[model samples]
Target: MKALVVYESMFGNTQQIAQAVAAGLGKHVEVEVTEVGLAPDEISAELDLLVVGAPTHAFGMSRASTRADAVKQAPGGTIVSTGRGVREWLEAVHPGGVGTMVAAFDTRVRAPLPGSAAHKVAKALQRLSFPEVSDPETFWVKDSTGPLKDGELERAERWGADLGLLVNSR
Candidate 1:
């Protein structure tokens, strides 16, 4: 089985979690990690699973205006996902998922936010005909530009491993 982990990050926290998740997935199947800017626009039949993730902005997935706002607040002026966000990538991806297992995840501050990037992504993927393989996941961050809450990376890795195992089993 092969899995692609695609992600968008404003600061570095989401990317770090994506890498950790990929590392865990690599243990159970062939896995590739890429930023949403460079992610493929089509999912081929050969790809067995797709994992999409992004940092929640203003509640849900980042929009152009939200992304611009994030860029302005980027720590050290270092924006990890300067080019594209998961929203744009999803918009442009081909509508097909006949044999593909899909999952969504997000990074956000541990607050009572009203929306979720993962949920939005999952809904979009479902609209594209992808069968969800798992419930949407959320990894907590400390602040806007975050140092992810302690052990969040480890938790994400475990979640990835479990996801990989689930797909491999099926």
Candidate 2:
């Protein structure tokens, strides 16, 4: 099976998780990982699974304002500006012919929040009639510009592997 793992990260924590997840998924199937800005405008018909991830901002997906705030918070202007984020990409993409095996994930503070980017992304995909293979998943970060919570990368990899197994069983 083929899979695509796309992500948006402000401080790079989410990107790390995305990479780990792709690594895990790669063990089971051919996978391609890309940043949201570089992702294809349409999901290829040959794909079996589509996984998306982003950093949670203000309880949900990051908007222009939130992204600007994140860039300002970074020390020494370390974060480079990536014009388009997952939110924008999701809003613009045509999900009509996308695969049904969709999954979403997000990186956020450990606090129990009412919303997450992952959840939002999953809902958006569902609106286009994509069947989710699993519930939205959250990976914790220590702070806004974070080193992810210890072991989260490993956990992400395991999650991807499990998802791959799930896809295979279908």
Candidate 3:
């Protein structure tokens, strides 16, 4: 079995969660984790699963303006993903087939939010005809440019493991 985890991060919190998720999936199958900027525009038919993730901006997926604003937040600091995010990348992605089971995840502030990047990603994946393996998930962060909330990465890993087993059973 094989899976691809493509993620977009602004302050590296999402990247860390993606890596943790991939680590759990790795136990059940070969898994590749890549940033959205470096992710392929076309998902391979050979993949049994595709996991997409990003950091929520303005309550949903990041747009060019949101990304630019994020850069503004980081003044002289380093930003993990400086280019296109999940929203832009998904706009041009071509899935190999609808047979591939898919899942979505996102990182957002712990505070109550009206939207989610994961929700947006799940809807987009449905539009592309990817088979939905599970409901979207959210990992919380302490703040906008955040270190993820304690235990969120662990939760992501557990979610990934469950997703792996769920897909394998099908």
Candidate 4:
């Protein structure tokens, strides 16, 4: 099986998780991981699984304004000013069909929050009729600019492995 893991990260925590998740999926299938800005405009028909992740901003997906604000606040992170984030990417992608299994994940502060970029991405995928292979998952961060809470990368890898199993079962 072929799997793609696309992610948007500001401070690199989410990028790390995306890499770890791809590593896990690699155990069961060929996988490619890319930043959301560099992701293709459409999901390839040959892909069996599509995993998308991002850093949660303002309790949800980060918008251009939010990302800009984050840059202003943090001053020195790899925040992309000219690239499309996962939210914009998701909005623009037209998946071929419902055959591709989809999963979503996000990095967020470990708070009792009501929103997540992962959940919103999952909802968008659902609207496009893609079957969800896993529920939206959250990897915790300690703060806005974060070193992910310890062990979160391990957890993300495990989630990816589980998602691979789910896809293989189909």
lDDT of model number 3: 0.90
State residue 155's C-alpha deviation in candidate 1, in Å: 0.4
lDDT of 2 at 73: 90
Q: Which stretches of candidate 1 lie over 4 Å from their true place?
A: 95-97
Q: After superposition, how far is residue 123 of candidate 3 from its true place, in Å?
A: 0.2
- Give per-model TM-scores: 0.97, 0.95, 0.96, 0.94
Candidate 4 has an lDDT of 0.87
In the order shown, the candidates' Cα RMSDs to the true structure are 1.1, 1.4, 1.1, 1.4
Q: Candidate 2's error at 2, in angstroms? A: 0.4
Model 2: residue 136 alpha-carbon error in angstroms: 0.5
- Candidate 3 lands at a TM-score of 0.96
Off by over 4 Å in 2: 96-98
Give the 10-residue window scoring lowest on summed lDDT in candidate 1: 94-103
Candidate 4, clashing residue pairs? none
Model 4 TM-score, 2 decimals = 0.94
| Candidate 3 residue lDDT tens string, 39-143 | 999988999999999988897899989888888897485688988889989999998765888999999987755989999999999999998999999998998
> In model 2, what are the clashing residue pairs, if there are any?
none
